[model samples]
Target chain A: MIEIKDLQKNFGDTKALKGVNLTVPDGELFAYLGPNGAGKSTTIRILTGLTKISKGRARLGGYDIEKEPRAAKRQFGVVHQHVNLDPELTVFENLDIHGQLFGMSKAARRARIKELLDYIELTGRAATLIKQLSGGLKRRVTIARALLHEPGIIFLDEPTVGLDAAIRRRIWALIKKIQLRGTTVFLTTHYIEEAEFLADRVAFLDKGRIIALDTPANLMAMAGAWAIDQFKDSGMQTHYFKDRKQAAAFQTDDSFTLRRVNLEDAFLSLTGKKVQP
Target chain B: MINECLAIYRREMLILKRRLIRQMAGQAVSPLLYLVTFGYAMGDKIRFDGISYLDFLLPGLVAMSSMTRSFAIATDINVARFYWHIFDEFQAAPISNVSYVAGEVLAGMTRALMGIIIILGLGLLFGVHLAYGPMFWLPILLNSFLFASLAVALAMLVKNHADQSLLVNFVITPMAFLGGTFFPIARLPGWLQSILKLLPLTHASKAIRQAALGKPVNLHSLALLAALGAVIFLIALGCVNRARD
Candidate 1:
């Protein structure tokens, strides 16, 4: 659904995206992950046509973003990191206005708003002003607003930040449902667990560059945090292997078990910082 | 493209209509304050061609309202950038660049018109005079739209809200004061009078005050303002497109 090649974006003396290249297939849930200022957000901005490229080419659904921006934009739904809803408008009105932006008719907008309200569980709060809703609810409405056009791809920039665990889980579940409908999901998240749970493929970025890219399980397995903790009658023994593959492939029988690692451990090993708890 | 612009226009008008009372209150109260303060409280002592200060000040107050409405529009462009992130949304959408610019300009124009319209209505209540014909609205409307466009352009160019406000206070306010808003430009020295002729609002004030005081329209002043407005609008657009780069 999306293709970017030799993407070089510079802001004055600072290079935000340095010769970056990425491709996201249709119906794939891809997470672009990195620490702060790793150019993850920059890459997303470029993909969504919010920023100009210093040099390179980007195509969405076969339409060039620079040459045919309108067509390219028509292919994706976008939800930015910041919640930018009109606090003065009702939840339904907010969605309705967005629908109208894309040329949706009043009746079509009404039916779509109702469907989105139900999907986001904001039906009762439909007539209430957005400022009256909680942060989680506001975020849901933003998601609903993005889907008003039913685009082929959804570009979500950190959609689950600052939410409680239950709300995060619910949002994640909703995202999974979006993925199940065969829409491409391109997201950038500071939340390690979010990338782990929702991403079919994760790209590790650092300093405007992608250092590593693979599935979450693959990256974790590739992080190579190998350990051997042995139990004896007198004392317990803990041993660290040179690499994860060694520990992962080490012999295990009924008496002992080989452990499995997740994206957090992989992130810590690769980036040398603890993932956000 | 024009259709998209009309959509934006309608959306803005709807917001103004939905908050009609609030909009009226906001626009009406400020000009009324100026009318009361300058027309009645400080109507004595100051003279222009042996005329009372109220007569001199009322026209100034009218021009001030127009300029201030332009400022208001410029400052509020942050609505899209900071509040709704509508600019970001537009950057990604299938909307044309003209539509994006038109949406903001139309909103600003409407606000400027509101300020001008209210000032016209209140001018009569305060015993302040204006051109009687409906044709007087021509220059007033054009002046408001051009200045409003300039303001929206400034909004797009300024890096932050604080910077935008500083420009309004330091540049816009000074221009209004020096452009014969509060007094007669004829009192100035020959060199300064020549410089004042270059200012858009100088010509704007010249055109508006003449039409109000029942003098023949100054074609040269009208031409100068229109040309100046065209140049400023083009420059503003250049600033906006450059910022995008």
Candidate 2:
């Protein structure tokens, strides 16, 4: 339900994004992956109407962000990389305030906060100051804050950074539950496994360009079997393929040698193992 | 617009009220020190436009309290929020930018007004007095809000703690000193006096002291300060919205 056309942003002499474009269908879990400073946050910021796109237009749910910022923004829920809770407030109050800003009534806000609190498993510390909470709890509060309004599209920027494995898995499950409920999620993450597991379709962004865009498995199939075998270097042989029929060959192998193409391999193949911003 | 602003105001009020004693006590130091420095050391020797230094300095001291109080809030609370990324919540929220600016302006005004009140209270202990009545609050509130808005604008633009302190010295100190806070601009030569009249606080002080000394109300001075204040407030809101955008 979102379309971006040639989004470009410039900060003085630095060109952050150059003619970047993409789309996300309704209820699609679209992952935007890029190295740091590759304009991932800039694109998200523009989509939210927080920053001006120097040379392009962006639309959310068919509404132009610049012309219909309020309406566009109303349909968006964002969880920035930073912990977006007021440190002075309690966990429940953070969600409540977030809901209230979108014009929710107190009774509704109260019920919603309680529901979200239970969703994130923070009911016990609902009364504690955000500053007093652990990092995982605060991140959960941020995710809960994003989901409070139940917008059609939820945007997460590096949502799991600094989170422990257990908490990260829990949050990933939370996101999966959200998608199951039919919310479109547009997310960016450095963790290849996250993109592989969560994103329905992934976009590899390099140097402000979409180098590759496909399902995780399809991209992996591009990594030939011989190379895959050589890379795996295992007693258990690795079988790979150029297409889906051949891709299933690994599954049928007696040695159980299998080729699984995730985002990390796709990323390495498209843009060598070198950094790009 | 006002309701969202009220939410921000209420949040700030919660912080201030929870630490009411501590907040009030911290504000007392600056004004009290200024009071003693001007009222005790120079009150006897200085005379300007037919008044002792303490008597002349009182109105200015009251205005300065508001000025510094507002600056102090932005410096301590608002600045820290930006650095810690606590401000990201507000940016991502549904609250209007104007409402956010108004809420923060209200916080600054509250602290500044408190400082002004503390100085006024201490004034009575000096056994020196000006006309004290409810009517006096009009000018006081006007000047306090005016300066507080300016402080909010500065907070949105100023780079760091160093720039913050520099503003207090370079901008506010000069405005207080040259704007007839302690002595009448009429005593200066015509060229200097004309330049002094351009200052917003000059009009702020004139309106304040006119009400304080129970003199006839000066509509011109009140209008000028109010107009300058309104412009700065609008510009400040615009700057904040731009920074956010």
What lDDT score goes with residue A205 in model 2? 79
lDDT of 2 by residue, B1-245 (tens): 67667767767776677678988788777667766887787678887667767777888777656566765666744554566554555665566668877888888888877777888888888766997565456666666667778777777786566777888888877876788776788889999988888877777677777777777768887677668778878877876655553
Stretches of candidate 1 above 4 Å error?
A224-259, A275-277, B14-23, B44-52
Error of 1 at A58 (Å): 1.4
Q: Model 1, B1-245: lDDT tens per residue?
A: 66556656666665567677987888899778877886678777577877777766666666666667765766555775766776676566677766766676667767777877787788778777656564455556567667877886788787778888798788788887898887888899999999987777787777777777777878887776667667766676665555564
Quote the lDDT for B91 in model 1: 65
lDDT per residue (tens digit) for residues A59-165 in model 2:
88888888877678888899888775677677766677677677787888888888888888887777898889888878888888888888899999989988989
Q: Which stretches of candidate 2 lie over 4 Å from their true place?
A: A224-260, A274-277, B41-53, B76-81, B158-162, B186-189
Local accuracy of candidate 1 as per-residue lDDT tens digits, A1-277: 8898998889999998888788989999999887778888888887888788899999999999888888888899999988877777788767776776777778998998898899887777788988799988888888888898999999889898888999999889989998998999998987888998999999887778777788887887765446454667775444445566777566464434455556666766677665463
Docking class of 2: acceptable
- DockQ for the candidate 2 complex? 0.41
Residue B132 lDDT in candidate 1: 50
